[model samples]
Target chain A: MRQSTFNNKFLPYILLLPTMFILVVFLFYPAIETFRLSFFKVHPWTGATRFAGFYNFIKIFSNPEYLHSFVLSAMFAFAVIGLGLFFSLLIAILLNQKIAGIRFYRTFLIWPYALSPAIAGALFNFLFNPANGVLCYFTGYRSWLTDGRTAILVVIIAAVWKNLGYNVIFYLTALRNVPQAALESASIDGAGAIKRFFYITFAFLSPTSFFLFVMNTTYAYFATFGLIDVLTEGGPAGSTRILIYHLYKDFFVHSKTGYAAAESLVLFTLVVGITFLQFQTSEKKVHYQ
Target chain B: MKQVKMAVMMLIITVVLPFAVFANGGVDVDESATASIEFWHAMSGERIDLIQSFVDKFVAENPNIAVDVQYTGSYNDTLNKVKSAYKAGNAPDVFHSYEIGTLGLINSGIISPLDEMADKYKKDIPWNDFFTPVQSYYKYQGSHYSMPFNSSTPLVYYNKTFFEEAGLDPENPPKTYKGIREAALKLRAAGHETPVTWNLHSWYFEEMICLQDEPFVNSDNGRGSELPTKVAFNSAAGQKVLEWWVGMEKEGLFLDVGPGWANHRAAFGSGEAAIIMSSSSDVNRLTAALAEKGWEMGTGYIPRPEGAKGGVAIGGGSLWMTNNHSNEEELAALKLISFISEDESQIAWHKGTGYFPVRKTAMDQLKKEGWFEENPNYLTAFNQLLDSPESLNTAGGLLGIFPEARELIQSAIQEMYAGKPVKKALDEAAAKANASIEEWNDIMQ
Candidate 1:
């Protein structure tokens, strides 16, 4: 790796200043403030705070709905990551083939990447809505939104569908980078197609997979708030209430800042713990070439 | 910039100084009294134009007052904007909030009570001429805290065309819970899959409880000096409302469109549902929507349970004056809201949108113009309001934690739809609401 030398130390510091300022202001300051807020009881309108010493934490922890949301969010994140990556990789592989109008297919397949989650949710909502829905018309008007389990599935499907284009884009790039020489040699050496893919291509894709795993986890945890909000609004008996959605209702809708801060802390810790676990276990298997 | 600041300072002194002196001594407001103030509102779409039209008229008439009107998003979004703006010390001189937000805003201490402002400015608002229900809803601690602009109640909107097709009388819409069910059965037998739906909202729940003349909260429906410690939504009245609601869903007679305002309207507009309980303000939109489908829409008071004697509570937004503005700006905002609520503006607003005219005089004006006879659907909303007996329950509940409680009740309804027993669901919702109420009280302390 070539390293560039800076002519002036002050110049290097000045170059770093803007990003550092943003980090402190947008990220670090809020994190510290949230941590502090988690321990207090906050008046919603007046913005007054009183030190409550674990009251807010205890309140959320003891609530079954909050616990349900926490578990639901974790499961939802994993489901999104697993299904999003699988379908996208499959589609990416197919699109990589030299077919007629491949460029057109690729462009169309990746178009959903440009859409925000709320739009995706709205589309899915219209298609599957029980009353006069286009997809509901085909499904004999089965009500998908009113049932708890199915509503969660609907949200998951919407989230996965919204995210597929992004995943496919990255996977397509990774598939293209797979060395043609190694694949040809493996084929010449009598390796079957499946064996070649597993032994060679899959190994190279691990690094990309690891990168996607982290990104998708973050996306599932955070990015799906808008999708869930628009589609279900954490309803059907709060079955679709993911942690971020619950946090939003608490902080924004209900105006319970202290409780929301405590909830956010839990969510933050859960995401961090998952990412740390992933790095510890999955990072070891990544084959960086 | 320094010179500009100096000019602004001079302007404030020259303009505001005399206004303060005149405000203390003079009975008449100076037409030349100049003050620029921002008015943030939650009304979107064409209503923005309607609001601007009247405000423009007011601005033209009072040439010195520059009103910067902004269309902030929804009621929730507008309140959030005000919160941030207030913390930043640039809150709007006046902003709009919904009916349910009355208690929280009162407790929020960010508002200048309208009665106090009226007293300070020596401007007597036509309180006696204002509608009783509308005025009482905003009266906190025996004082008017906000100016009621748009007052609405939920009404049962039925498709007259669908009713006639179903062999039900188009003129005689269902007026009771049992009547509604029978009407639904007739409509469904006539090949309508779902005969009814309302947006999955606690507003209907709250209204139904009120229709029974039952208080939603124990402390005089949170109208007393004591803050509401718990909700009455788990009581028999509340459970009865849910049982009917969830029962219709179970029998596949009601379409559950979840929360928010759109889906239920969509269901009714497309003839997927023949009857819907929605805001009185939805009269114009839903009527137009059904007309697009060549269906005639009818309006009725939202059906009550058998022998229920209570009436509907108001369900729209009001304009609140913020505490931070200068007296000059305050006086200007007062004038602006007063003008908006007057007979002329209220009549225009009522005709343009289905929201009720807050003033009795406006109602009389609309009646004199023969507006209701031509648009009888409009009369149903007004008659429903006039017919309502004044009571603590009919006045509507006030609570510092109403927003959270509303969500709890909405989720409980969803839970009931998911096959949870009505009583259990209401009980759980009430429990959670009580807990939140407790927490809010503690925090406010």
Candidate 2:
């Protein structure tokens, strides 16, 4: 009986072993290896590796380009996350209404989310192209990507457009889970639409908002890399060169894998620090009940 | 039980019949019985059809051997695919490579050095008969490991429509920087929107390096070494060239454009831009696309600053042998290489594409056939490359990691085009790039 009980308890782990093993091999292993390589200098041509302590990190801070990229990354991250959440919540509230063809609206709203960032970047590039671009023809804006001020602005807009749909889906799902009784009670108390929404709906959606805040911040850091690559290629003097994009340049374009690893470690610490901050600040505000 | 036995017999026959085809390999494998070879090349578009036609003619003539051809994407993509294939132990029998830093792969025991293979096969072609100017691009450590293919150098591409409006002769393009500046002024006077469009940074700077006789990197004679402690691109010649470019920008004589040189070609084709500087290989594509637009096109050698020495540096890529295959497989690959390098095949490549021939004998044969008479546009690029004296620094450049160096140069150039001081931007880029070089050298040591 005891043997059977023990087997039953261990069977779940046995079934999960393959998945756990794969995750470790593909994800955790590379992460650990990258972390270890952060202390090395790599030969660009021969791909030979050697330990160099924190020289790469030191170099990262000292190099003006690297510093610029880090600042750009922070700016890109916050701007994307803030705009993505704001627009998604607004769209979600509008779509939550009992309108005609709600199903059609849902499908249409989520369509852009299905297109990959690389494709989105390409399409946006064509639209933003100074010459022969549709946007330039209509708006009379020349060299949108070549100008530093306009380049970052266009990148942020592209990010928000590409990302708002996914966040809307999350917001709509959270809104659906909101209790009808509470809303009705608030309405009976003569609460205005804005007041009810602010007190009831907003409070209820906090958990979802928090989840998306973390997720969007992460996505802004990593997933937007492909967008930058295809759109601006971190160009117009590296104005749009975010941290992950810089990491890509270091690893592939520069073939400085070790230096890239060091940059990646710095990025990892930044992300972790922000996430910890989010958790600490939000613990009191999150109302599970 | 009796029916089951009959069914089993039918199944066996069904499976065994297909084995007959399998025994012969696939139908596309081209069984000529003399050890069939697979040749993977990155040639695409019209170049694809040209290569296929050549292979077809070769197969028709050399019935004893078969040549299989496949198209991969850009040069970098081709190199990556080859590397992965080598790692996976299933590399192609023959593949195209670049004259870039890929020679390191050969030195690192990833590619079979062609000299040893030549001795073993006793099939060495006369090295002296190859184009002398194109010879340096195909070597590593004093030995040839590749055959130069689709070799090119940047040239000045002008719009005849703009030239006519500016009252300049269509036949004579600029041969000196003074002439180019004068042409730019004339075009602006004639009210052309964009008088010039060029791949601002690379073609502008690298052409100057070749024109002024300076090497971009040092030690393996610019085949990419770690010995250069500094980027000398900030030298007088480099600065002078950069200043000229900046002056053009200031005068609105040229505009910065790209998805690299190809985009510039497209802009020139669309009539949005007048003159463009690009590769000879692109002439076929440009002419094909733009000729029907009724805008006449003119070509010229890259114009130099007054009294500049040396010639334009070589552009385009080469096909290298990798060490991932067995001796027999490499031999099969060499046979395919030999087949492509023949005089007849080279003419087909040249006529079908505007790229220069890599072998001298092929050029001589093509000249005899009056190819230049038929295609007048080929003369400009051909004469420019042939007449230009080859220099170590002028012929080609080597850097520790050429792709990285290209990125640094490109990034800095982008900054300069955006109106940063050329010297300051270049100096900053040089420092960063040198640091990368030092890092590379340390690891290599």
Clashes of each: 0, 4
**Cα error of candidate 2 at position B121, Å:** 3.3
lDDT tens string, model 1, B1-445?
9999999999999999787767557345564678999999999999999999999999988888999999999999999999989877899999999888888888887889888788777778888898888877877778898899998999999999989999999999999989999999999999998889988888988999999999999899999989889898799999898889889999989988778888888889888899999999998899899999899999998989989999988889899999988667888999999999898899889888889999988888778888888999988988898899999889999988888888888888887887889999889888888888887887776
Docking level for model 2? acceptable
TM-score of each model, paired residue for residue: 0.94, 0.88
Q: Report the C-alpha lDDT of model 2 over B1-445, residue by residue, as the tens digit.
A: 9999999999988998676545434223232346566777888787888888877877786677577788878666666666557656766677776556553445445666666666555565677877777776565547777766777777788888779888998888888778888898888888876677776446557767778777676563455433555566666777778778767877878766634444576678777777777778777777766687987788888878888887876676666666655455566666667777777787778777777887788888888888778777788888887777876766666655667666777778777777789889888877776776666555655
Against the true structure, whose TM-score is highest?
Answer: 1
User: For candidate 1, what is the DockQ?
Assistant: 0.64
lDDT of each: 0.89, 0.76
Q: Which ranges of candidate 2 are over 4 A from the true structure?
A: A1-14, A43-48, B1-41, B44-72, B81-94, B102-109, B219-227, B258-262
User: Where in model 1 is the C-alpha error above 4 Å?
Assistant: A1-6, B1-33
| Tens-digit lDDT track of model 1 for A1-289 | 9998878869978989999999999999999999999999887876778899999899899989899988898899989999999999899999989989999999999998899988988898888776666877887755687778788899999899898999999999999999999999999999999999899989989999999999999999999988898888888888999999999998888998998999889888988998899999987798899
Pairs of colliding residues, candidate 2: B110-B323, B111-B322, B111-B323, B222-B398
TM-score of chain B of each: 0.92, 0.85
